[model samples]
Target: MIYNLTYNGIIKVSREHLSNKLEVGFNTISTAFKYMEQSKLFILSRNRSGKTNCGYRVILDMQHVNFESILSEVYHLKAYEIAIVKDEFKQPNKYQDLAQNAYISTLNGSNSTLNYNNQI
Candidate 1:
């Protein structure tokens, strides 16, 4: 959802709007936004002055973002570290393979290792 919204570069939208669009509760969206902000995926600013009902301002710098870090930080999934290692190989084309292997390993409750040469 945040990825899709990146096309706008920076967006100002209410938590209620995001909740309605994602079909989730407002508090959930709010918490997710806090996580996202803490993860450095984006900058979140609120209308704290209370003068107006304007929404949050989200500033995204997609170019320098490490999405795997965001996933690990925000979702608290250590398995995404495999994705970070895969990224270190500079093999963007094999990202899907590594991700799938990581998921499969998690599902099978095994700790599969990857070689430095990018082999699973």
Candidate 2:
């Protein structure tokens, strides 16, 4: 969902909708969003004004060329290279020699979990 949302250059997200889609609790989604925001992967517009969210802007993925033009036109967002982050988060190789395991680089931020955006 995150990948698709970012790739599509759509930034708005709702805890309720994400909760339903991911079959998780609203609080769980909220917590995840909080973590992402803290990690700088997303910029959240937090609201304590009763169960309503103001949505968020996902950290733009510059390596994903498909979204650049769309994002510029839609949100006037110019995505800058995140400096070695995008390449480090790509999916694992589909075909690797069984004898040699390629290390899949993990996404590291100030305080974040292992990023598996490739799968999401």
Candidate 3:
């Protein structure tokens, strides 16, 4: 269902929505999403400064990582003719938060403006 509903690699799927659609528990949908994320089959949207909705991007075309080409070829989009989707983490982000959070202790009690010079 998600594959059929997806548009331009972007899909707005929620745990509850999937649960209702698939006739399964919400937790089941959540676990399935987690497994897909770990396997790099989906990219869940991270909370941004102003984004208020919960959504995700589905990577249906595993053979192509360059999403711009999908727009050009499938959607017939021109480079200068439109605005692009503002995807923060365009690729798989399964362990991105884990790695960043693991090093947060080093940033505490220090001026964040100063450079650590790739120490983390």
Q: For candidate 1, give the lDDT.
A: 0.56
lDDT tens digits, residue span 1-120, model 2: 566655663456567777778899988876776655445443344334445644443444333455446545655554554323344445343333331443345356455443333331
Candidate 2, position 45, lDDT: 46
Judged by lDDT relative to the true structure, which candidate is superior, 1 or 3? Answer: 1
- Clash tally, candidates in order: 0, 0, 0
lDDT of 1 by residue, 23-98 (tens): 9998898788776665544545664447666646444433434545544654465875646644544534433565
lDDT of 3 by residue, 7-75 (tens): 446444566667887899977877776766665544454432356655543334332345566647655
Candidate of highest lDDT: 1
CA error at residue 57 for candidate 1, angstroms: 3.7
CA RMSD, predictions in order? 13.5, 12.2, 12.1
Consecutive 10-residue window with the lowest summed lDDT within model 2: 93-102
Clashing pairs in model 2?
Answer: none
Clashing pairs in 3: none
Off by over 4 Å in 3: 5-7, 46-66, 69-120
